[model samples]
Target: MSTYSYRIVNVFTQGDDPFSGNPLCVFESAESLDTPRMQALARQFNLSETTFMLPSTRANARVRIFTPSYEMPFAGHPTLGTAHVCRALGLAGDTLTLEMQAGLIPVYATQRRWTLQASANGPSG
Candidate 1:
């Protein structure tokens, strides 16, 4: 068996409530994981959404979002949550871009708070 590092975070929280907002699980590195493994990991986490981090040629990093049942091209909370993890890992600065299935997303962070710029046309697939 192989070991992987992951972080769980709450997005869109108000004040200091740790339990508030949506819960998300982000895998620090998914260089070795395939689609099946990623799907299984998402199922194992059993959260609304789980994300994996990968190397990117178009942006600071690449992100893949998955639910227990399916993969999503893009998602708001997941994008922000993943961006937060990216910043924590020093993969990118306060302002960075995440390449997603939908398209490229630009994220900005201030401390623990994170935000993403959505595509005007929205996700494609």
Candidate 2:
């Protein structure tokens, strides 16, 4: 049997409301899980987005974003949530870079707030 660890967080929260922001699930570690398993887990969580953390050669860590139906190259809330989890788990510091399918993303944290640098080009024109 295999046990996976994960954390649930709210991004873009307003005030102290727990349900104020978008909910995201971030898997603490996904080095053993494959694409199919990751997809299934995302479907099981049924959140707007789920993130898996993996080791990265180019950045602090590698992140994969997934929805119930398919995988996403990148997403804002998920990126922020994952960065928060990374910092909590000692995987990264206040400023770290995440390697995503879309590209390498730079994330920064100030206190409890997290931010990510967006790409110049949009997904679609």
Leading candidate by TM-score = 1
RMSD (Cα, Å) for all candidates, in order, is 1.7, 2.6
Cα lDDT of model 1 by residue, 33-118, tens digit: 99999999999999999999999999999999999999999999999999988888988889999999998898898878777787
Report the poorest 10 consecutive residues by lDDT, candidate 2. Answer: 116-125
Error of 2 at 53 (Å): 0.3
Candidate 2 lDDT over 1-125, as tens digits, reads 77999999999999989888999999988999999999999999999999999999988889999999999998889989999998999988899999999888889999998878875793221
Clashes of each: 0, 0
Q: What is the alpha-carbon RMSD of candidate 2 to the true structure?
A: 2.6
Ten-residue segment with the worst summed lDDT in candidate 1? 116-125
Best by lDDT: 1
TM-score against native, each model: 0.94, 0.93
lDDT of 2 at 45: 97
